[model samples]
Target: MTDVAPPVSRPKVVRHQLERLIITGELAPGDRLAEVLLAERLGVSRGPIREAITALERDGLVVQIPNRGAFVRVVSEADARHLYEIRSALFGLACGLSASRHTGSVDIELRGLLSSMRGAAERADHEMYFDLNRAFHRTLLETSGNPFLAKQYETISRSINLFRARALTIPENVAASLEEHERIAAAVTSGDEERARSLGASHIAGGFARHLGESVVAS
Candidate 1:
Protein backbone atom coordinates (compact mmCIF):
# COMPACT_ATOMS: atom_id res chain seq x y z
CA MET A 1 0.00 0.00 0.00
CA THR A 2 1.29 3.49 -0.81
CA ASP A 3 1.94 5.47 2.37
CA VAL A 4 -0.12 8.51 3.20
CA ALA A 5 1.48 11.59 4.69
CA PRO A 6 0.57 12.23 8.30
CA PRO A 7 -1.97 14.98 8.69
CA VAL A 8 -2.37 17.53 11.50
CA SER A 9 -5.65 15.91 12.46
CA ARG A 10 -4.77 12.30 11.89
CA PRO A 11 -7.82 10.88 13.63
CA LYS A 12 -10.28 12.91 11.57
CA VAL A 13 -8.54 12.18 8.31
CA VAL A 14 -8.18 8.52 9.15
CA ARG A 15 -11.83 8.31 10.12
CA HIS A 16 -12.94 9.74 6.78
CA GLN A 17 -10.68 7.36 4.86
CA LEU A 18 -11.91 4.39 6.85
CA GLU A 19 -15.49 5.50 6.35
CA ARG A 20 -14.88 5.61 2.61
CA LEU A 21 -13.40 2.12 2.64
CA ILE A 22 -16.31 0.63 4.55
CA ILE A 23 -18.94 2.51 2.55
CA THR A 24 -17.34 1.57 -0.76
CA GLY A 25 -17.30 -2.10 0.29
CA GLU A 26 -13.52 -2.30 0.36
CA LEU A 27 -13.89 -3.10 4.03
CA ALA A 28 -16.94 -5.29 3.78
CA PRO A 29 -19.35 -5.76 6.63
CA GLY A 30 -18.02 -8.08 9.33
CA ASP A 31 -14.38 -7.49 8.29
CA ARG A 32 -12.12 -6.74 11.21
CA LEU A 33 -10.31 -3.47 11.66
CA ALA A 34 -6.83 -4.48 12.69
CA GLU A 35 -5.23 -1.46 14.30
CA VAL A 36 -1.59 -2.36 13.82
CA LEU A 37 -2.12 -3.35 10.22
CA LEU A 38 -4.21 -0.27 9.51
CA ALA A 39 -1.62 1.94 11.19
CA GLU A 40 1.03 0.57 8.86
CA ARG A 41 -1.24 0.86 5.84
CA LEU A 42 -2.10 4.49 6.63
CA GLY A 43 1.39 5.50 7.80
CA VAL A 44 0.09 6.56 11.22
CA SER A 45 0.43 5.28 14.73
CA ARG A 46 -2.21 3.05 16.25
CA GLY A 47 -3.53 5.97 18.30
CA PRO A 48 -5.22 7.65 15.39
CA ILE A 49 -6.60 4.39 14.13
CA ARG A 50 -8.07 3.65 17.53
CA GLU A 51 -9.55 7.08 17.76
CA ALA A 52 -11.02 6.78 14.32
CA ILE A 53 -12.55 3.45 15.20
CA THR A 54 -14.24 5.04 18.19
CA ALA A 55 -15.72 7.74 15.96
CA LEU A 56 -16.95 5.13 13.51
CA GLU A 57 -18.76 3.40 16.33
CA ARG A 58 -20.65 6.59 17.07
CA ASP A 59 -21.39 7.07 13.39
CA GLY A 60 -23.04 3.63 13.22
CA LEU A 61 -20.48 2.39 10.72
CA VAL A 62 -18.55 0.02 12.97
CA VAL A 63 -19.15 -2.37 15.83
CA GLN A 64 -16.59 -2.39 18.63
CA ILE A 65 -16.03 -5.52 20.65
CA PRO A 66 -14.71 -5.54 24.21
CA ASN A 67 -11.33 -6.92 23.25
CA ARG A 68 -11.59 -8.03 19.64
CA GLY A 69 -11.47 -4.56 18.08
CA ALA A 70 -13.76 -3.01 15.46
CA PHE A 71 -15.57 -4.42 12.46
CA VAL A 72 -17.62 -2.86 9.70
CA ARG A 73 -21.22 -2.71 10.91
CA VAL A 74 -23.87 -5.14 9.78
CA VAL A 75 -27.37 -3.78 10.08
CA SER A 76 -29.95 -5.89 11.82
CA GLU A 77 -32.91 -7.08 9.78
CA ALA A 78 -35.29 -4.88 11.78
CA ASP A 79 -33.06 -1.82 11.49
CA ALA A 80 -32.67 -2.30 7.76
CA ARG A 81 -36.39 -2.60 7.25
CA HIS A 82 -37.10 0.41 9.42
CA LEU A 83 -34.69 2.68 7.55
CA TYR A 84 -36.02 1.61 4.17
CA GLU A 85 -39.56 2.26 5.27
CA ILE A 86 -38.71 5.77 6.42
CA ARG A 87 -36.85 6.61 3.23
CA SER A 88 -39.65 5.16 1.16
CA ALA A 89 -42.08 7.58 2.71
CA LEU A 90 -39.83 10.62 2.46
CA PHE A 91 -38.67 9.90 -1.06
CA GLY A 92 -42.15 9.12 -2.24
CA LEU A 93 -43.35 12.52 -1.11
CA ALA A 94 -40.28 14.18 -2.59
CA CYS A 95 -40.91 12.61 -5.96
CA GLY A 96 -44.52 13.73 -5.89
CA LEU A 97 -43.54 17.25 -4.97
CA SER A 98 -40.87 17.30 -7.66
CA ALA A 99 -43.42 16.41 -10.27
CA SER A 100 -45.82 19.03 -9.01
CA ARG A 101 -43.38 21.87 -8.30
CA HIS A 102 -40.80 21.53 -11.06
CA THR A 103 -40.96 23.86 -14.09
CA GLY A 104 -39.12 21.67 -16.60
CA SER A 105 -35.70 23.20 -15.83
CA VAL A 106 -34.24 20.14 -14.08
CA ASP A 107 -34.76 17.84 -17.08
CA ILE A 108 -31.32 18.43 -18.57
CA GLU A 109 -29.58 17.88 -15.27
CA LEU A 110 -31.53 14.72 -14.54
CA ARG A 111 -30.83 13.37 -18.04
CA GLY A 112 -27.10 13.98 -17.69
CA LEU A 113 -27.06 12.24 -14.31
CA LEU A 114 -28.95 9.25 -15.72
CA SER A 115 -26.49 8.94 -18.61
CA SER A 116 -23.54 8.92 -16.23
CA MET A 117 -25.28 6.43 -13.97
CA ARG A 118 -25.86 4.10 -16.94
CA GLY A 119 -22.18 4.15 -17.74
CA ALA A 120 -21.22 3.46 -14.13
CA ALA A 121 -23.72 0.63 -13.85
CA GLU A 122 -22.49 -0.95 -17.10
CA ARG A 123 -18.94 -0.93 -15.73
CA ALA A 124 -20.09 -2.30 -12.36
CA ASP A 125 -18.59 0.68 -10.64
CA HIS A 126 -20.67 0.51 -7.47
CA GLU A 127 -18.90 3.41 -5.80
CA MET A 128 -19.53 5.77 -8.69
CA TYR A 129 -23.03 4.50 -9.18
CA PHE A 130 -23.80 5.03 -5.50
CA ASP A 131 -22.64 8.62 -5.59
CA LEU A 132 -24.56 9.34 -8.77
CA ASN A 133 -27.61 7.66 -7.35
CA ARG A 134 -27.49 10.04 -4.40
CA ALA A 135 -27.05 13.03 -6.63
CA PHE A 136 -29.98 11.99 -8.80
CA HIS A 137 -32.27 11.64 -5.81
CA ARG A 138 -31.01 14.82 -4.19
CA THR A 139 -31.78 16.75 -7.33
CA LEU A 140 -35.31 15.47 -7.31
CA LEU A 141 -35.72 16.35 -3.64
CA GLU A 142 -34.40 19.85 -4.17
CA THR A 143 -36.75 20.34 -7.07
CA SER A 144 -39.56 19.60 -4.67
CA GLY A 145 -39.09 23.10 -3.20
CA ASN A 146 -39.31 21.85 0.35
CA PRO A 147 -36.18 22.66 2.32
CA PHE A 148 -37.45 21.23 5.60
CA LEU A 149 -38.35 17.94 3.99
CA ALA A 150 -35.04 17.80 2.16
CA LYS A 151 -33.16 18.47 5.38
CA GLN A 152 -34.94 15.61 7.13
CA TYR A 153 -34.16 13.30 4.21
CA GLU A 154 -30.48 14.21 4.31
CA THR A 155 -30.25 13.57 8.04
CA ILE A 156 -31.75 10.13 7.64
CA SER A 157 -29.60 9.48 4.60
CA ARG A 158 -26.36 10.05 6.47
CA SER A 159 -27.40 7.53 9.09
CA ILE A 160 -27.43 4.75 6.51
CA ASN A 161 -24.81 6.06 4.13
CA LEU A 162 -22.85 2.83 4.25
CA PHE A 163 -25.87 0.57 3.80
CA ARG A 164 -26.76 2.13 0.46
CA ALA A 165 -23.61 1.05 -1.37
CA ARG A 166 -23.97 -2.60 -0.49
CA ALA A 167 -27.31 -2.80 -2.30
CA LEU A 168 -25.56 -2.43 -5.64
CA THR A 169 -23.34 -5.47 -5.15
CA ILE A 170 -25.53 -7.70 -7.29
CA PRO A 171 -25.03 -7.20 -11.04
CA GLU A 172 -28.73 -7.57 -11.80
CA ASN A 173 -29.55 -4.97 -9.16
CA VAL A 174 -27.68 -2.38 -11.20
CA ALA A 175 -29.91 -2.94 -14.23
CA ALA A 176 -33.06 -3.06 -12.14
CA SER A 177 -32.13 0.13 -10.30
CA LEU A 178 -31.40 1.97 -13.51
CA GLU A 179 -34.66 0.88 -15.02
CA GLU A 180 -36.53 2.11 -11.95
CA HIS A 181 -34.76 5.42 -12.19
CA GLU A 182 -35.77 5.79 -15.82
CA ARG A 183 -39.40 5.24 -15.02
CA ILE A 184 -39.32 7.59 -12.05
CA ALA A 185 -37.60 10.22 -14.14
CA ALA A 186 -40.18 9.91 -16.85
CA ALA A 187 -43.04 10.23 -14.41
CA VAL A 188 -41.53 13.25 -12.65
CA THR A 189 -40.69 15.02 -15.89
CA SER A 190 -44.13 14.37 -17.26
CA GLY A 191 -45.71 15.96 -14.17
CA ASP A 192 -47.38 12.74 -13.09
CA GLU A 193 -47.16 13.35 -9.36
CA GLU A 194 -49.09 10.29 -8.24
CA ARG A 195 -47.18 7.92 -10.48
CA ALA A 196 -43.86 9.40 -9.44
CA ARG A 197 -44.80 8.99 -5.79
CA SER A 198 -45.86 5.39 -6.20
CA LEU A 199 -42.79 4.48 -8.23
CA GLY A 200 -40.49 6.23 -5.79
CA ALA A 201 -41.83 4.31 -2.82
CA SER A 202 -41.82 1.01 -4.67
CA HIS A 203 -38.28 1.56 -5.88
CA ILE A 204 -37.01 1.89 -2.33
CA ALA A 205 -39.05 -1.09 -1.19
CA GLY A 206 -37.71 -3.14 -4.11
CA GLY A 207 -34.12 -2.32 -3.17
CA PHE A 208 -34.72 -3.67 0.30
CA ALA A 209 -36.13 -6.87 -1.16
CA ARG A 210 -33.13 -7.26 -3.42
CA HIS A 211 -30.84 -6.64 -0.49
CA LEU A 212 -32.52 -9.32 1.58
CA GLY A 213 -32.32 -11.74 -1.33
CA GLU A 214 -28.59 -11.06 -1.66
CA SER A 215 -27.95 -12.12 1.96
CA VAL A 216 -27.71 -8.77 3.68
CA VAL A 217 -30.38 -9.76 6.15
CA ALA A 218 -30.66 -12.72 8.49
CA SER A 219 -33.71 -14.96 8.35
Candidate 2:
Protein backbone atom coordinates (compact mmCIF):
# COMPACT_ATOMS: atom_id res chain seq x y z
CA MET A 1 0.00 0.00 0.00
CA THR A 2 1.28 3.43 -0.87
CA ASP A 3 1.79 5.72 2.05
CA VAL A 4 -0.45 8.79 2.04
CA ALA A 5 0.51 11.81 4.14
CA PRO A 6 -2.14 13.16 6.47
CA PRO A 7 -3.44 16.56 5.55
CA VAL A 8 -1.92 19.41 7.53
CA SER A 9 -3.85 22.61 7.87
CA ARG A 10 -0.98 25.00 8.46
CA PRO A 11 -3.09 28.10 8.48
CA LYS A 12 -5.44 26.71 11.11
CA VAL A 13 -2.54 25.59 13.26
CA VAL A 14 -0.92 29.00 12.92
CA ARG A 15 -4.14 30.70 13.83
CA HIS A 16 -4.53 28.62 17.01
CA GLN A 17 -0.98 29.36 18.08
CA LEU A 18 -1.40 33.04 17.39
CA GLU A 19 -4.60 33.08 19.41
CA ARG A 20 -2.84 31.43 22.34
CA LEU A 21 -0.11 34.04 22.17
CA ILE A 22 -2.66 36.79 22.42
CA ILE A 23 -4.74 35.12 25.13
CA THR A 24 -1.74 34.37 27.32
CA GLY A 25 -0.54 37.98 27.17
CA GLU A 26 2.63 37.18 25.27
CA LEU A 27 1.14 39.29 22.52
CA ALA A 28 -0.59 42.16 24.25
CA PRO A 29 -3.13 44.50 22.77
CA GLY A 30 -1.63 47.06 20.36
CA ASP A 31 1.42 44.84 19.86
CA ARG A 32 2.46 44.83 16.22
CA LEU A 33 2.08 41.44 14.59
CA ALA A 34 4.62 41.48 11.83
CA GLU A 35 4.04 38.82 9.21
CA VAL A 36 7.72 38.13 8.78
CA LEU A 37 8.37 37.80 12.50
CA LEU A 38 5.41 35.49 13.02
CA ALA A 39 6.35 33.38 10.03
CA GLU A 40 9.84 32.88 11.37
CA ARG A 41 8.67 32.25 14.95
CA LEU A 42 6.04 29.69 13.94
CA GLY A 43 8.41 27.99 11.48
CA VAL A 44 5.89 28.57 8.72
CA SER A 45 6.17 30.54 5.53
CA ARG A 46 4.69 33.99 5.07
CA GLY A 47 1.80 32.57 3.06
CA PRO A 48 0.42 30.55 5.95
CA ILE A 49 1.07 33.37 8.42
CA ARG A 50 -0.80 35.83 6.24
CA GLU A 51 -3.65 33.40 5.80
CA ALA A 52 -3.85 32.84 9.56
CA ILE A 53 -3.74 36.59 10.22
CA THR A 54 -6.61 37.15 7.81
CA ALA A 55 -8.62 34.52 9.63
CA LEU A 56 -7.89 36.12 13.01
CA GLU A 57 -8.89 39.50 11.59
CA ARG A 58 -12.21 38.02 10.53
CA ASP A 59 -12.58 36.64 14.04
CA GLY A 60 -12.19 40.19 15.45
CA LEU A 61 -8.92 39.38 17.21
CA VAL A 62 -6.64 41.35 14.95
CA VAL A 63 -6.81 44.69 13.17
CA GLN A 64 -5.06 45.72 10.00
CA ILE A 65 -4.14 49.34 9.48
CA PRO A 66 -3.57 50.71 6.00
CA ASN A 67 -0.14 52.03 6.80
CA ARG A 68 0.74 50.44 10.15
CA GLY A 69 0.30 46.73 9.39
CA ALA A 70 -1.53 44.22 11.63
CA PHE A 71 -1.75 44.41 15.43
CA VAL A 72 -3.74 42.83 18.23
CA ARG A 73 -7.01 44.73 18.43
CA VAL A 74 -7.09 47.28 21.26
CA VAL A 75 -10.64 47.28 22.52
CA SER A 76 -11.47 50.71 23.95
CA GLU A 77 -13.56 51.25 27.07
CA ALA A 78 -16.60 52.40 25.07
CA ASP A 79 -16.28 49.45 22.72
CA ALA A 80 -15.92 47.09 25.67
CA ARG A 81 -19.02 48.54 27.31
CA HIS A 82 -21.05 48.09 24.13
CA LEU A 83 -19.84 44.54 23.71
CA TYR A 84 -20.63 43.78 27.36
CA GLU A 85 -24.16 45.04 26.93
CA ILE A 86 -24.77 42.61 24.10
CA ARG A 87 -23.03 39.89 26.03
CA SER A 88 -25.12 40.58 29.11
CA ALA A 89 -28.30 39.93 27.13
CA LEU A 90 -26.95 36.77 25.59
CA PHE A 91 -25.66 35.47 28.91
CA GLY A 92 -28.99 36.14 30.56
CA LEU A 93 -30.79 34.16 27.88
CA ALA A 94 -28.35 31.30 28.06
CA CYS A 95 -28.50 31.08 31.83
CA GLY A 96 -32.27 31.19 31.77
CA LEU A 97 -32.33 28.31 29.34
CA SER A 98 -29.79 26.44 31.39
CA ALA A 99 -31.89 26.91 34.51
CA SER A 100 -34.91 25.50 32.72
CA ARG A 101 -32.86 22.51 31.60
CA HIS A 102 -30.72 21.93 34.67
CA THR A 103 -29.65 18.43 35.59
CA GLY A 104 -27.89 17.03 38.67
CA SER A 105 -24.73 16.18 36.81
CA VAL A 106 -24.53 19.57 35.08
CA ASP A 107 -25.13 21.37 38.33
CA ILE A 108 -22.42 19.35 40.03
CA GLU A 109 -20.00 20.15 37.26
CA LEU A 110 -20.68 23.87 37.48
CA ARG A 111 -20.34 23.85 41.24
CA GLY A 112 -17.02 22.08 40.91
CA LEU A 113 -15.80 24.75 38.53
CA LEU A 114 -16.88 27.46 40.93
CA SER A 115 -15.00 25.76 43.73
CA SER A 116 -11.89 25.62 41.61
CA MET A 117 -12.25 29.25 40.72
CA ARG A 118 -12.50 30.18 44.37
CA GLY A 119 -9.32 28.26 45.15
CA ALA A 120 -7.53 29.97 42.29
CA ALA A 121 -8.68 33.32 43.49
CA GLU A 122 -7.59 32.60 47.05
CA ARG A 123 -4.16 31.70 45.80
CA ALA A 124 -4.04 34.95 43.83
CA ASP A 125 -3.64 33.00 40.62
CA HIS A 126 -5.34 35.31 38.21
CA GLU A 127 -4.52 33.25 35.15
CA MET A 128 -5.91 30.06 36.59
CA TYR A 129 -8.99 31.84 37.82
CA PHE A 130 -9.49 33.49 34.47
CA ASP A 131 -9.40 30.17 32.63
CA LEU A 132 -11.75 28.51 35.14
CA ASN A 133 -14.07 31.51 34.92
CA ARG A 134 -14.30 31.00 31.17
CA ALA A 135 -14.97 27.30 31.62
CA PHE A 136 -17.73 28.06 34.12
CA HIS A 137 -19.61 30.33 31.71
CA ARG A 138 -18.95 28.07 28.73
CA THR A 139 -20.38 25.14 30.62
CA LEU A 140 -23.51 27.14 31.37
CA LEU A 141 -23.95 28.14 27.74
CA GLU A 142 -23.45 24.60 26.53
CA THR A 143 -25.94 23.31 29.03
CA SER A 144 -28.46 25.84 27.77
CA GLY A 145 -29.09 23.49 24.80
CA ASN A 146 -29.65 26.41 22.50
CA PRO A 147 -27.08 26.08 19.73
CA PHE A 148 -27.77 29.52 18.24
CA LEU A 149 -27.45 31.22 21.61
CA ALA A 150 -24.25 29.32 22.33
CA LYS A 151 -22.76 30.31 18.98
CA GLN A 152 -23.51 34.01 19.41
CA TYR A 153 -22.19 33.98 22.96
CA GLU A 154 -19.02 32.26 21.79
CA THR A 155 -18.31 35.05 19.29
CA ILE A 156 -18.85 37.82 21.80
CA SER A 157 -16.84 35.94 24.41
CA ARG A 158 -13.87 35.79 22.10
CA SER A 159 -13.95 39.52 21.51
CA ILE A 160 -14.47 40.12 25.20
CA ASN A 161 -11.29 38.18 25.91
CA LEU A 162 -9.38 41.24 24.79
CA PHE A 163 -10.27 42.87 28.10
CA ARG A 164 -11.72 40.22 30.43
CA ALA A 165 -8.48 39.42 32.22
CA ARG A 166 -7.79 42.98 33.16
CA ALA A 167 -11.01 43.29 35.11
CA LEU A 168 -10.45 40.07 37.05
CA THR A 169 -6.92 40.89 38.18
CA ILE A 170 -8.12 42.82 41.18
CA PRO A 171 -8.33 40.63 44.25
CA GLU A 172 -11.51 42.25 45.46
CA ASN A 173 -13.05 41.84 42.04
CA VAL A 174 -12.14 38.17 42.03
CA ALA A 175 -13.79 37.67 45.37
CA ALA A 176 -16.92 39.49 44.33
CA SER A 177 -17.05 37.65 41.02
CA LEU A 178 -16.94 34.33 42.85
CA GLU A 179 -19.88 35.39 44.96
CA GLU A 180 -21.81 36.26 41.82
CA HIS A 181 -20.91 32.91 40.32
CA GLU A 182 -22.21 31.23 43.43
CA ARG A 183 -25.54 32.99 43.10
CA ILE A 184 -25.71 32.14 39.42
CA ALA A 185 -25.00 28.50 40.13
CA ALA A 186 -27.59 28.47 42.88
CA ALA A 187 -30.21 29.91 40.55
CA VAL A 188 -29.43 27.42 37.81
CA THR A 189 -29.39 24.43 40.12
CA SER A 190 -32.56 25.49 41.82
CA GLY A 191 -34.19 25.97 38.43
CA ASP A 192 -34.93 29.61 39.05
CA GLU A 193 -34.90 30.76 35.44
CA GLU A 194 -35.73 34.40 36.10
CA ARG A 195 -33.18 34.76 38.87
CA ALA A 196 -30.54 33.04 36.77
CA ARG A 197 -31.19 35.44 33.92
CA SER A 198 -31.07 38.48 36.18
CA LEU A 199 -27.93 37.37 37.98
CA GLY A 200 -26.16 36.49 34.74
CA ALA A 201 -26.86 39.91 33.26
CA SER A 202 -25.83 41.65 36.46
CA HIS A 203 -22.54 39.74 36.52
CA ILE A 204 -21.60 41.02 33.11
CA ALA A 205 -22.68 44.52 34.04
CA GLY A 206 -20.47 44.41 37.12
CA GLY A 207 -17.52 43.39 35.01
CA PHE A 208 -18.23 46.23 32.63
CA ALA A 209 -18.28 48.69 35.50
CA ARG A 210 -14.99 47.36 36.82
CA HIS A 211 -13.45 47.63 33.37
CA LEU A 212 -14.58 51.23 33.09
CA GLY A 213 -13.08 51.95 36.49
CA GLU A 214 -9.81 50.45 35.36
CA SER A 215 -9.85 52.62 32.27
CA VAL A 216 -10.35 55.68 34.41
CA VAL A 217 -7.47 54.71 36.66
CA ALA A 218 -5.22 54.06 33.71
CA SER A 219 -6.06 57.40 32.16
Model 2 lDDT, residue 117, Cα: 94
Predicted structure 1, TM vs. truth: 0.81
Q: Write the per-residue lDDT of candidate 1 for residues 1-219, one digit (tens) a residue.
A: 999986568689999889888877778778999999999988999999999998888777889888787888877778878888998999999999999976757888888999999999888898889889999999998998999989888766765666677877678988999999999999998999999999999998888788666644433
Which ranges in model 2 have alpha carbons more than 4 Å from their true place? Answer: 1-13, 40-48, 215-219
In model 2, pairs of residues that clash are none
Name the best candidate (by TM-score).
2
Local error of candidate 2 at 94, Å?
1.0
Q: What is the alpha-carbon RMSD of candidate 2 to the true structure? A: 4.0
So what's the TM-score on candidate 2? 0.85
C-alpha lDDT of candidate 1 relative to the true structure? 0.85
Q: Where's the lowest-lDDT run of ten residues in candidate 1?
A: 210-219
